[model samples]
Target: MAKRRLGGGLICGLLLAGSVLAAPPTAVIIGTPPQPDWTQLTPAQKSALAPLSKDWDSMESVRKKKWLGIAERYPKMKADEQNRMQERMREWARLTPEQRAKVRDSYKDFNQLPAEQKQTVKEKWKAYLSLPAAERQRLREAGKSVQLLTPPQPEPQVDESLAPAIVGESPASPGAVPQ
Candidate 1:
């Protein structure tokens, strides 16, 4: 009878442990975070909050909270810094989920590029934008002929697998000649 009682106690102890393990976390691991009250933020967070109102009800709780925190803290930040942060928040709201994921994945690569490369890309884009509509159309039409005139790229016999890692970068550097 003592052995049976001990076995029953052990089973109850195990059941209790399982329940404890299954209990909800005191600290949330994921999902949306909490948003502070909108009234709590200072002037900058208030400004940031202004553009957010339209979408606030639909935003993830964490993001909503993050914006509220921004409002709370932004009063101490410089005007320029606050404005830039606000712009980023605004842009974040504008992107679709797929676009946001793509940007999230490639953002590190974009951030890693040097200033000169960034400038080069900007200059090329500006030039492309500045060209007249007719000229742009002409260039697109010419591209087909240009491709036809180009010689076939012969595969090199060199075993790149056996070759040393080339220290050089790709030809597509943002600021490099947009060839």
Candidate 2:
């Protein structure tokens, strides 16, 4: 009985030790690095990210890092390129969540397209965006109108004479005796 008790105790100790070793590590609480103050941001960084200023502090740390990276690169970009980035950022901010999802899905689909088709889509989209706002709206309306006005295919016709012949009877002509 004593030997059995020792064996059971040994088994229990081994199981406890195994569980201790297999347990996941506890999360360590460590001091996070301080976020940069808005004033501490470089003038160029502030300017390039102006639209985000109001919500900057509320942004996640990871997002702040990403914006900081962009800000760092912004000064090196050409004027036109910087303008394009700013415009894109503004547009992104203005999008609803559903709209953003659509953009993301479309981007993923575009990335999966063949290179030539992707280029064609890119060119067409650029051309579409380059038009004045009113012209773009008018073009969209025209496209809808065209879709609505499209003529449908005519119904298939069966010649009455051939129809009777197919059924093993002659179609009687006007003022003629039926055979």
Please, what is the whole-model Cα lDDT of each candidate in the order they appear?
0.67, 0.76
lDDT of 2 at 178: 48
Assess candidate 2 and give its lDDT: 0.76
| Cα TM-score per model | 0.40, 0.52
How far is 28's C-alpha from truth in model 1 (Å)?
Answer: 8.6
Task: Provide the clashing-pair count of each candidate structure.
Answer: 4, 0
lDDT of 1 by residue, 1-179 (tens): 99999999999999999998896868856767455555655565667677665567676777777667777777788989888877887887788879878877666755666776656556665776687888777876878433432234446776665443332433345233322
26-50, model 2: which lDDT tens digit per residue?
8998654666867878888899998
Candidate that scores best on TM-score: 2
How far off is residue 103 in model 1, in Å? 2.3
| Candidate 1 deviation (Cα RMSD) | 12.5
